[model samples]
Structures are given as C-alpha cells and as structure tokens.
Target: MNSFGQAVDASNLDKDVKSTTLHSVGDAAPDFSCRTTDSREFKLSAQMGRVVLLYFFSSSNPACFAQMKYLENEVFQKLRRRDDFQMIALGRGHAREELVQIGGEHRLTFPLAADPKQEIYTRYFSKYVPRIVVLRWDGSIAYQASGADYEGVLRLQEVLARELAAARTR
Candidate 1:
C-alpha cells in the first residue's frame, strides 16, 4: 500500500515497482497494446521493423506539454516523412477522452495513445510522467529520459537518428 492517501492493492502494482528496477538501455522493451485517441489500437510489436520514439507523459503536466511541443516542432516535423521511424506519444495512465483533448490542445501531429491503467508506463518504469524511451527495431531499449529537459530531448533526437540509420542497414 502506497502512502499517498489512496488505497493501493499490492497485487495491482507491477513487479518492477516492488523491485525498484526501471528498464534501461540494452533491455528488451515489454510489448504493450493501448487505445489511441482516434479509437484505434496501437501495438508496440507491430512496429518491430522500425525504430520507435515512445513518449510517456501526462495530460495535466506542464512539463509534459512543453516536451510535447518541443517534439512536435523539433523532432516529429523532421522525421514524419521517414518510413523507417515512428513516433508515438502516450498519455501516462489517462483516459481516451483526456488524451484526445490533450492532443487537440497541443496540436500534436503524431499518434497519441491512452494508458488509463499505466500498464505500459509501469513496464518501462514506476516513475512520474514526461518520460521518453527509444526502442530499436528488434524491440531492445536504446535510450530513456525521465525528465523534460532540452538537452535530454535533443540527445534523444541524436540517438534516434543514429539508431534509425543503423536499422536501415539490416
């Protein structure tokens, strides 16, 4: 049971939360499926042949909003045309309606997914929102960022470019 005033069930929490181990580079990313804001399903395994930049954020977070805007203006604008790469932003443990509203407000161009149960979030790490994870073509973790900092976001872009370039050779 967590001490945040909300009743918590031990069984409901992911094992990693108890172990306090968050996935890092070289680890295999756990596959997950979630409902997009457009009501379509998104499966991580389906994007195996392409490098993916997955952003986990919260709709209500200001830092998350800034990060999304930065991504839209800087990263997604440059990479949307490429076939070997894909970007997805998931609202960390949020509902579909909330996700759609957030996307609309931010004018996000990339696909947005809802994670009401935080299943995917917990799989990567039992941490707060505004996190980014880069996954290689074979589903291995390549990079991860826990905060919405310019340097981290920029570094993610660099790492992603390198990974995408390498994936094309295979």
Candidate 2:
C-alpha cells in the first residue's frame, strides 16, 4: 500500500491473481463456455470474429427486469439485426427453467444463459447486479459497468451502437 492508501501495482502478480481483479476497459475478456437457456452451447472463443455483449443479472430481480426492458427496447432491437454482434443475458442464482420462464415472460429476443453456479458472474464481476460487459471482435473489453440504471443503460445503448458500427467496419 502507498501513502495515498492505494495498493501497489500488481502487474507482476501471478496471472490467476490478476484475473480475479475486476476487468478493466481494455482487458481481454476471460473465455467461458456455457449452455444457453435455448440448450445451445456458447463458447466465447468461437465469438472471436464478432462483437459480444454479456449481460449479467439475477432472473428474479425487478431491477434486472428493468435493465432488460431497456436493453430490449433500445439496445437489442437494433443490435439483434446485425450479423456481427451477439448479446447473451446470463442469469445468476437462477435455474435453467426459471431463466426460460423469464425469457418467455419478457419475450426476449436475445439468448438467455444460465449461471446458476455463478461461475461466469464471479469470474467477471465481484459484486452488483445488471452488470454489462461489451467485447470487441478480438475479445478485448470495449465497455463494462456494474449497474444498469436509466442513464447507464442509455449510455450502454450508445456504446453498443458505436461498438457495433466499429465491428461492422472491421
């Protein structure tokens, strides 16, 4: 720790230790594999050529529902039509059946993935719900945030639009 009370640089720490830290803007997103609520396999490595947006939330939370609604109305509607982009809503602390039910209830257009074990959630973020991680085509993070309030979602919408445009041009 320094006199300013900040921990010293950890760049030289073990890779595993570094990975546990919150992912920053330019960090390469950790690759993960999981089954979508639709029963299809999703491998992060396979998405290397496309932009990816990973939305982490609890299926039972109303705030998460609001976040999804904003994403559905403003973000997904536009991004879903693109060929070079994919958005997967990952449900933490929710069963596969619950995730499917929520998706059906919301008429969500994007795929919903289950993280009942919280493996994916713990790997990316330490706390907070409705977190969003936007990845570029090469797998580096373009944008990331822990909360999805109205303004935050709006900003995310803009970021997604800009990232999608950049991905298409690549």
How does candidate 2 score on lDDT? 0.79
| Candidate 2 lowest-lDDT run of ten | 1-10
- Candidate 1 residue-wise lDDT, 33-131, digit = tens: 877777778899999988999998886667778878989988899899998888899877788888778888879989998888888888877765677
> Any residue pairs clashing in model 1, and if so which?
none
* Model 1, runs deviating above 4 Å: 1-21
Per-candidate TM equals: 0.85, 0.83
Q: Count the backbone clashes (under 3 Å) in each candidate.
A: 0, 0
